[model samples]
Target: MPDYDLNRLGSRAFEQMVVALGRPELGPGVQVFGDGPDGGREATYDGTINWSAAAVGVPGGSEVWVGHTVLQSKFQIKPKPQPQDNAVWLQGEISKEIGHWIKAAKAGRPRGTEA
Candidate 1:
């Protein structure tokens, strides 16, 4: 298993989620802390767009967290239509990520054994 830092992993995962969303306008706002000689304690990637199609984060960990918030054209309590055509883009993104995950899993399997 690959050991990854929580904040770094979260940021990367958030960025990947945005790319996976396929909406150029929906890219996340990423910020990093601790760039100086002394390393800082935290970092974050704030995503402005809501990912109704997918969620990111580990399955079972207290430190693991996932959140999504959709922005409406107006501040209304009722649901509203998203301006971008997200259906097709979301499908393609899911397919691509699933394929990559499958490939990685296969590659990680023991040599000469069924994947």
Candidate 2:
């Protein structure tokens, strides 16, 4: 579980990821929607080239959500390659995308800071 609300955080993360990847048009492909009382919401990211992501909100003080990205079934037929299995690589990519958002949120700052 993540420290922030998964649905919200994940959606933001996915959006940032797209932008960081230099695909501004793809950012909007990540959608956030209500999921009722059982949870906060769901993030629907467009599945393209076997890539997709989702986030779920859960109750907790330290963490409120869990986010995950998956290679679509069609692309996962073979075992995960070594490069794909590297935790650092995945973490770096995700962090590069979401880390700024998380930092801004924690600092009570807005996006697009000049400082």
| Number of backbone collisions per candidate | 0, 0
Clashing pairs in 1: none
User: lDDT per residue, candidate 1, 1-115, as tens digits?
Assistant: 9986433445445444444444344454533333232111123344554444344463432232244322211112222256354555556655664565466567785211333
Can you write out model 2's per-residue Cα lDDT over 1-115, one digit (the tens) per residue?
A: 6586323435445444433453332345555443232111233344442222322342332322234322111112222457557555656656654666567668887433526
TM-scores of all models?
A: 0.25, 0.25
- lDDT of candidate 1 vs native? 0.40
Against the reference, the lDDT scores of all candidates come to 0.40, 0.40
Q: Find the 10 residues in a row with the least total lDDT in model 1.
A: 71-80
Off by over 4 Å in 1: 1-84, 109-115
TM-score of 1: 0.25
